[model samples]
Structures are given as C-alpha cells and as structure tokens.
Target: MSENNRYTLITGGTEGIGLELSRLFAKDKHNLIIVARNKERLEKVKKEVEKEFNIVARILSIDLSVNNSCEEIYRFVEKNNFVVDNLINNAGIGSFGSFHELDMEKEEKLIEINIRSLTKLTNYFLKKMIDEKTGGILNVASTAAFLAGPKMNIYYASKAYVLSLTEAIHEEVKDYGIRVSCLCPGAVQTAFQNKAGIMKNDKTKGLMMSPKEVARIAYRDFKKGKVIIIPGFKNKLLVLGNKLASRSLGRKIVMHSNKSK
Candidate 1:
C-alpha cells in the first residue's frame, strides 16, 4: 500500500485528547478512521477534518463499552479496505466516588471500555501490523497508573493496567518494527473531569494541561517510538515522586489529592 493510503484509527476521536490527536494526525496528511459513540459529533469532526486537511476521515459510530464492539470496529475497517497503519486506543471513562457506592453497571462498562475493548482492538490490529511488518499503537494511560487512587479507584486501576500492558507489548514488539507506546498524561482540561464526577474546585485544576498540548507532545514522542510518553514535566515529576516514595505514601498522597480543599 502507498504511504498516502495508510490510515490511523482513533477511538473516542470526537472529543478530548482523542479529538486533538485526530487533528494532529490529519495535519500530517494521515488518513483517519475515527470511532466514537456519538454519530452527530463524529460526522461533524469528519466533515471538518476532511475539508481542512484534504484527507479521508471515516467515522465509525459505536459504543466501545458494548459487547463485541471492538470486533465490529475491526470488521468495519476490513470491509472498507482501510489499512490502519496506526491504532490509537484512546477511548476511556472514569467514575468517581467510593468503590462500594459507585454504580456497578457503570463500573462494568468502564472496565469494558478501558480494558477489554482496548486489549481486544490492540490484539486485532497488532496481528495485522505484524503481518505487514510495520505499524504503531499508542495506548492512552494516565499518571494515576503509578499510585493507588481512593475516590477514583477503578479508573486509576484501569489506567495502571493500560500502562503495564502497553509497556510489555512495547518490549515484545520492538523487534518487529511495531512501535508501541503508552501515553500517561496528567489532568487535562476536558469533559473527562466533569464526566468523572470531579468538581470544579478540585486541586488538579492548577495542574491541568490542555488536550492540544498533550496531543502534540504525545504524537511527537509516539512517533519517536518512545515506550512511555508522559506529556508534562510536572507529570513526569509526579510519577518520579511516587516512585521515590513508599507505595503507601503514594497512596496517601493520591487520596489527599482526591479531596477538594
């Protein structure tokens, strides 16, 4: 296939970091297959990017949290003959509150979106890329992966799994010329906070990074085949700080940070 024909597939590509990454990839002349739950938003993004970048922006409207949705995405690209040269597993959701008090259904869907679908999609595309002997996978994790979270328990745990899985795959696939990188970003100014039940007055407000900035840095580092891409310097420091401290201390810090002052 020609370089011009290669496509990048991004999940949750209608908003937040995923949306920013779409613009960056499109700016570089990469064709895109963006998957999101909202058909209206997806169509709007597709129209805008296709017109601005002069590249194809195919949109797939599907809820990744649903059963077999990942398989449906794989089939969509295959049927349309879209060669995904890069797969961005960027779809994720968070639920804040005590684990016991949280809605079980939401938590289940969170696991389905953040973990199962990501793993499934990665598995599907990684095989194709390996056969072609070229491709990249960028899994969006978070700094929360480094420490235990209190009120935001399941989300942190899910991100930790992403971090670990991506790191392991990065090592395993480097020999095959498949660049696998995990993007561990700090708090970003996006709908994620509100959706996660995080209040406006939260402490992370001071550290919030813009989605565009995060996506720019992420695209740069991922293209470099960096195994772990932490967007902000302060976020890097936070990860390092957690490592230097005891695990229990790190948990306590996260717990305290979870509270609004």
Candidate 2:
C-alpha cells in the first residue's frame, strides 16, 4: 500500500521510548521521519520498522545539539514537501553530577539538545499543525520536571521547561484543534542512565518502566488530548506527592537520591 502524505516526525527516534513510539505510529500505517545522530542506528531502525509495520520510514541523521540543527531539520522537511502531521520532541540528554563538577561544554550541549531543539522544532511545525488544525505535538518531559534534581540538575530544569512550554501551548492551541502534551515518565529501561554516568542500582530497576510501556501510555494519552501524561500509576502518585511535599523534604529526598544513586 502507498503511504500517506502526512507523517510523524520524531527526534531521537532510533531507540528507547522514541523508537517504541515510532512503532506505535507505524502500526497505524502512518508515515514517519525519524531523526537521530547515529546514521547506522537510524537506518537500521528505519528498515526494521518499515518491514515490520509495512509503512514508509525515513531517517534523518542530525545532531540536535549543534546550532541551527532544528532549523536545518525544518528546512529539510519543507524542502522535501513532507506534510508533518505530528511532531514528537523526544530527543534529550542528561548529565549526572554536581553543578560544579560537570564540564560546562557538555552541559551546554545537554541544554541545547534537551531544551532548545525541542522549542525550535515545535515553533517550526506548530503553525503548520494549526493551519491544518488536525494534528498534535508531544514533548517528552520527565518526572524530574516536578522537582529539582540535585545530581541531574540541568536535565531536570530542561524538562521543567518542556512541561511548562507544552502546557502553555496546549492551552493556546487547543481552540484551534491542535493537541499538545507533555510526557513525564519516571525511570525507564533505556541506555539513558548509562550514558549520563548514572551507576546501575538494583533498587532503581524495580521502579523503572519499560520504554514500550511508557510509549504506549504516552501515545494513548496524547491522542486523548491529555495535557500531562505520567505513564505508570506509581509515577502519577509520586508527582502528586512531590507537589504536596514540603520544599525541604523534596530537597532532602532529591539530595539523597544524588548522593546514593
């Protein structure tokens, strides 16, 4: 079957939650344009998803941390005349360290990839979604967004920005039939922790949600126009508790998490 003109553009779609989300979208016969830095991984995922779901999948290798990467991606999509019906800003990075101990250059790239790229991509496609008045945006925030993460401090702050932005835009564009959602999932079974210098703890594994499970809930909730999507039931409760907890208690909790885990 010929693929539809409309496509879902997912950043960081080569693996983890982004990859699972791609499968979900493609299962419905949607065309996809997946962006990731590793060309080999992107091509592999493209071929696998295309064959498994019998849908067209395109790969775009771009480092979202680079300046103007979002602009470059936007231009590529426009130049190719792909009708982006959905935008999934799932590309992000995390740093695990004290604010003073981390390298500033890496921290800057983390912010660039996690915050700036997401905002710019949304800005580029938001108007088009508004004009079409039939699609949505899913910004992948995290459970870290609710409170200050002492160890992964900048990463947490970046997610807070994502959740805030998604909520504000969700309200702004709801009347125009454009859905916006912030996905705030807790720890997931991905290479994120390893990449971020987090040591594996058996204690955390029990709490971790699988990428596919998180993706399923995220996709379902976003489709239903839910503004804040916290995947697991325990995660929802944690977010609630974080909001109600005293500031000192929250700080102590996160600080302990940093020192121990």
Best by TM-score: 2
Those runs of model 2 whose alpha carbons end farther than 4 Å from true positions after fitting are: none
TM-score of 1: 0.96
lDDT of 2 by residue, 98-217 (tens): 999999999999999998899889998998888888889999999999988888889889998999999999998899988899999998999988898885576778679999999999
Clashing pairs in 1: none
lDDT of 1 by residue, 1-261 (tens): 123557999999999999999999999899999999899999999998998988888888899889989888878888878789999999999888888899999999999999999999999999999999999999999998888999999999999999999999999989999999999999899999898777657556766899999999999999999999999989999999888999999988878878652
Off by over 4 Å in 1: 1-5, 202-204
Worst 10 residues of 1 by lDDT: 1-10
Report the number of the highest-lDDT candidate: 1
